[model samples]
Target: MIGQTFNQNRPLSQSLDTQGLKTKTRSFWVPLSIFFVITALSITVLGPQTQSIFDTREHIVQLQQDNRVLVDKKNKLTSIDKSLLTRQARIAVSAIPVESSGLAALATVRNKAFSSNITINQLRVSEGESSEKDAAKEVRLQFEISGSLSDLLKFIDSLSKAAPLLRIASVKMVGDGVTISTDLEMKTFWAELPVSLPPLNTPLNQVNKKDQDLLGQMNNLKAESLGFVAPASASARENPFAPY
Candidate 1:
């Protein structure tokens, strides 16, 4: 009887020990699993959100920098005198027109020759060649003229100060030194205005000293233009005899 009692107590004690171990394991594993799940959620969900916030902040900083630059440009632009700017703009346009200005160039030559007392014998106009691509288109003018050598020299010198920017390509003089017949090959330039504009965000650069001097030179050039008188409009009478 004693041995049986001892065996029964031993089995009960063993069962109790196993139950205690299982309870401890469940308590440790529950908290560990919860921690692992929370860690995975943070990596999968919160990580991208944090990165996006940082990227947006960097973009905002870039935008602010661009805004400051634009503001500075605006200030500079506003400080310029409007009338002086307008005059410079006109001078530049008159110097290099946006279209083929062969007629205007011819008029300038005719006026200058008349003023210099040089008689033009023959005049020819043709297209000119450009050395660089996308450069100004040139109009070549061939002129045959007769005048006193002093007058011819005066005319040639005056051409440099004329508008449309004439370049003397060649000159040949014949006859006595007092009265000279000359062949003049001259070139004038024009270019089509830009059709495309830069983006609004592009940085603007003010005209530099070199460009200002160039503009001043252009302003000194004289342009001759032909004038036309407007015709009077005729009124119609109810009867043809009303005119009499």
Candidate 2:
């Protein structure tokens, strides 16, 4: 009886020990395995994506900076364009006019000669050959005048300062001690009306130093007015039946 009891107790104790060992394994190894699985998922799934997100943010910042720079450049270009247009308008006003004709130019020369006390013997005016590509038309004038040397010099100087901007092409002079006979060939310009303007995107050309100097010279020149016509009051018929 004593031996059987001891055998039975021994079997029961072994079974209890085996159950405790199983409980310890469930508590330790199961949690450890789960932790390892979660760590592997993080490394495999989220690690590469973290760097990609940061790179995308940096790229977006760079694009924003480039956009700001382009906007600033656009504003500056707009300001420059406005300034150029204003200057161009002023230059057009001071430039040789398009409305002038050979008759008008001849009249101007006659007026200048009369004012200078020079006698004009012969006056000829003609239009020069012009092409479609030219911006201005050329007008030629040949004239003969007689005056003392001092008076001739003064007349020539006045011509240089005259408006409708004459260019002296040639001068032939024959003197007979008492009076000098001068033949002059002069050229002047008249602008053609613009048919169309160039495209807006065309690049603006900067004025050169020489052209700027010429503009300054023109600005300093005195303005010349076309001779005034008498008002209607002066020409009105004092008698209603004068002429039609």
Candidate 3:
């Protein structure tokens, strides 16, 4: 009877121990699973917002850098002499005019020919060809002139240094010992200025040594007319369409 009572008590104790272990395991696993679920939810909800905040910070830094560059450019521009800039602008425009018409080029040619003692018998102006849309537009000028061989040679040489830049495309000459008749085809170029400026954030490039040298070379170009013209010699035109 005593042995059976001891055996029954041992089995009851073992059953209690198993129940306690199960309760402890349930408590541990329940909290662990809940922690994992909360972590997943937090990543899903806050990941995009965190990334957006980081991107915004990077953009702000980039804008700050751009602003600094623009301010530097503005300061440089403000410090420059306005008169000097104006003079340079004039020089540049005279070198390559804005009008596609060959009026400036024609004037230069006439002035040079007169100075060289060459007589222009015939002159014609026409448009030139361009391969690119935004390329410089060209104006073609054809000339028939007669002069002494020496004078004709001097006129051609002077054309190289004249402003409203001219390029002699083809030249043909027939001489009779004392006088020479020449046929000349020349080209002049013009381009339109951009109507709009770049964005405010764009960095302005300072004129470097190469650009300064180019400007100096253009400054050396011979202007078409340096002497004064008498304004009183002007004649009024009533009808340009009327035939002579």
Residue lDDT tens for model 1, 1-244: 9999998899899999999999879878978899999899889978888899999999999999889888887888789889988888889989999888788789889999999999999999998878987799999999999999999999999998999888899999997878999999999999887788666667777778998999999988999976564898665766757657
| Candidate 3 Cα lDDT to native | 0.87
Q: Which stretches of candidate 1 lie over 4 Å from their true place?
A: 1-35, 129-134, 227-244
lDDT tens readout by residue for model 2, 1-244: 9999998899899999999999878878978898898888779877778878899889889777766766665665666767765675465444566665565566568777888889999988888876766657889999999998888888887777665667799999999977999999998777756768654444345566887787666555344455777766654668777777
For model 1 the local lDDT of residue 173 reads: 96
Which number leads on TM-score?
A: 3
TM-score of each: 0.74, 0.56, 0.75
Q: Rank the candidates by TM-score, best first.
A: 3, 1, 2
Candidate 3 Cα errors over 4 Å, as ranges? 1-25, 33-37, 225-244
lDDT of each: 0.89, 0.75, 0.87
C-alpha RMSD (angstroms) for model 1: 7.2
The residue pairs that clash in candidate 1, if any, are none
Q: Across residues 34-141, which tens digit of lDDT does each residue of candidate 3 receive?
A: 998888877987787888889999999998899899889899889888898789888888888787748878888889999899999999999998889888899999
> Which candidate number has the best lDDT?
1
Compute the lDDT of residue 208 as modeled in candidate 1.
Answer: 85
Ranking by lDDT: 1, 3, 2
